[model samples]
Target: MLKNKNLIMIFREIKVGELVDFVNTVFYKNANIVPITPQRAISQANNPYAQPNDVALVLALNNKEEIIGFIGILPGKTMLTDERFFWNTCWWIDPEKGKIAAMPLFYSMLKITKSNLIFFDLTPHTASIVAKMGFMTNSITGTKVFLRFNLNQILPKKYAFLAILKPILKFFDSCLNTMFAKKSAKKELNYQVIKCFDASMEVFLSKFKPTMLTPFDNTFFTWISNYSWLTTQPNEFETAIAKKYYFSYITQSFVVELLKITHQNEFIGIVVVTCRDSEMKIPYCFFDDNATEKVLEAIFNYAYNKKITTITTFHPKIKEQLKLKKNTVLFTKQLVKHVGYPKQFETLGITNKLFQDGEGDAVFT
Candidate 1:
């Protein structure tokens, strides 16, 4: 619907400086728009296997000559829907700037991408405001923390950017892991690998809303948590097509024994981790507080064996506890929040109860 609607539209891939500038303006913070030195960026941008995110339609408003509002979109498969979608992801329109910045920018994006659904993450800070814009809670993706043993040994860029920040993260991951390890002793002692994709869909909603995390697109989140993906899809075409398109987005993380492990998989408690493909780069991994020390030991053991230098985790609690600096680079994939506020989730030929309550969907998505 956003078309030729006013504020002149300019579509282009976000230049690092431009994006950093916009982020600074909207968040009202001072930051350096440092060049992204991560090798991952190059993979998606240059590899044929890469399904790089689309950003050829960024909309920026200029009042006279001053830049005003902007919208950033990251494209992805609609959380649960089949059709391609262009999530309305991120928008920043300073009230004073008026619709000049908002209106045209939106229309321009609609004109460009071939998206059926669009969305934005509904974090605690932006929940109420997004809800007011006709958004509704859809699902809950818990943000968990994982304490790592070595900071410099796990992150990809530890030597470069985090050399100075390593000690802080090391201390943090250590303290939390110790605390969690103690608590694990009292946990229900239910580490039976409960079900190896076993015969159970037992999803126990956490009682203590750790981060007050909630989903704006509940169906999407729920479905993702359920029918998670693997290199193989139910159908051949879908699987082949997916891999062909998403190979880059899909990092080749080690598959258990494929990588080295020091600690045996006894009943150590597991931590929380977010593995979303966009927004932030690294997947989040928070450990069970009681089993934190074991986690660190295992992590260090793995590093030692594989000669792998570093790894990164985005678990908020762990990030804070470890004092890991924000990677500073964010990829905003556009998403359409829940299409309509459903009175009771009126399904329209959309039904997936397969993994209804198992595996937490955290590992698969």
Candidate 2:
């Protein structure tokens, strides 16, 4: 169909000044890009590490430019601290011009940079088209359930039982694992993880009041709390109040995770992900760059001590900051993934697999 079209589709980079305007015009008819705070947007553009990508365009190969389709592409893992590389409204094209005419411009975009995946977030319209372009659909069993490991919340109040009931619990776990492997017994099985609450977390939430947070809320809370000078105040009460509100927002938005950290103190800086159970058939755990090779050691230690099977959640590796680190209890970065097993997606019922972004839009990134 594009062969018959005469319009010469030319792709080019968008000027920083016009990025917001272009994003608005492109997604206006579909989803929204209006909620991103102006302050956050500017910070990204000014960051030294921010990867460059197309932000706007002068429609058609024209000089006196007017944008018809606006798109933003961001570098994966590495990005400007404040700037978000959007899977923006790249599909924005004039309907009258026809899909055949518009698609070439979209095709031209891959030349700018490669993305791990192009999310057909709003328009399922492009799914078939993009998939045909070589993007493989993930298997239904490949989906994951996001379990937030709230450092202070959801901890089992009864660690004493694990000691006294060790033998009985071990037998129970063995039976449950055996049954869980058989598809026939899977329907009636439930495996609850060991949980331990952080007293500091409980105290902090009580003193402060902030916005509700998702699993990603921990980092964002730290970021947004900087918005006000409250964090710098000398009064512990004032600071605690602000943080309390922030923590409350988190509990309301995301589910608590099922694990406990190796160390419960904050005297040092070591960030690690601990695992206690798996909602899916497999165990899942993640670590940041700072965790270094020590995280592996910690995981092995924990698994050995507990006598449990474990699997590490795969993420692009980063610096290991958790070394002085004994397996410290708090996590500093947001680890995201598709929800549920891929079977749910294959059956076309992957609703719970979706998540709302920090800014309030349901995004699949």
Candidate 3:
């Protein structure tokens, strides 16, 4: 329980071990407001790198025992510091019902993490708030290149009146795509889809790990690839639970896959492709600097074959190469992704470039 200016709020810190049971038993039935979904909670519980006692979520409840505020944490080990740090995944407070609890919820998280927290993919409002709390806000440049016209899927979400025009928009897409057919033609590339890492892949990554900002290992990637927060398929119970959850618990389709790309019968690059509905993101990609062009060509081919609408990437070389291949895509938008870290990280010499596009909990989502 916490008291702020005579306002009393009950806060519950859910540790890693308790996440699954808490969501399944208490949260499922009384989930008018939810901190995490059942599948996500299970995935967090199954994380091999996380400790059992690490606090994963903090919830604020009022006198009526209704959850009004929450902050989610994903425990991680920073390679540069070799110390424990928490990734701030999700934080929410109902504007009308939990306005007063917002600060308190943040304070609770700070106390639990002892200020060792990393925040990324922030909205403008959230970036402003975190800046005031002594966090250094930094940004990474990325691009979302549209391979196929998806105005029918994209515009309707922002302008409801356009929903009726979807048929026409789709018709336009069909005609335009037919005209640009040769540009998107799929090329055969030697690639292997693996559920888990093999010995050869582990050896290849070991050489590159030391130079990486986070230096995640095979075990970490295995956990990430196997236990995903989002799903392409959901059962009836999961569908029912999603209605009460605020975050992305369900989607039209979702899949995370590891692609081992080879050229001339030799391995060239490895990438993690995350597909949600029509969009695709290369969360984690590793390749030799010289192989950037080939790797991108492989990615474009994969996107074409999969019918991905757009591809988002933050790798500097990949983004630069995309600029050269502008004709291959319908359009491209520059994106600035903001990230926040405790000010103390400055003393550790951490910089904006140290982070990948898939930093924080972004890969899982």
Predicted model with the maximum TM-score: 3
Q: Please give the clash total of every predicted structure, in order.
A: 47, 40, 0
Q: Report the C-alpha lDDT of model 3 over 328-352, residue by residue, as the tens digit.
A: 7878899998888988787876763
List model 2 lDDT by residue over 112-156, tens digit each: 433332343333446555556665343211222222232122222
List the candidate 1 regions with Cα displacement exceeding 4 Å: 1-55, 63-67, 78-82, 92-100, 110-115, 124-136, 141-365
TM agreement with the true structure for every prediction = 0.36, 0.32, 0.92
Arranged by lDDT, best first: 3, 1, 2
For residue 276, model 1's alpha carbon misses the true position, in angstroms, by 13
| Model 1, span 1-365: residue lDDT tens | 22355544333345322442433353222211111112222221332211444552253534243335555443443224444444444555556653555656655555555423333344554455444544444542222222223343346344577767778876875675455322223222223322122112112123222322222122333333333233321354333333423122233342221111123544343322223221111222223555455554443333333333233443333334333322311111122222222222225222221111112222333
Mark the 10 consecutive residues where model 3 has the least summed lDDT: 181-190
> In model 2, what lDDT does residue 250 have?
13
Candidate 2: segments with Cα more than 4 A from true spot: 1-8, 15-49, 52-65, 78-89, 98-101, 120-122, 138-365
| Candidate 1 vs 3: which has more TM-score | 3
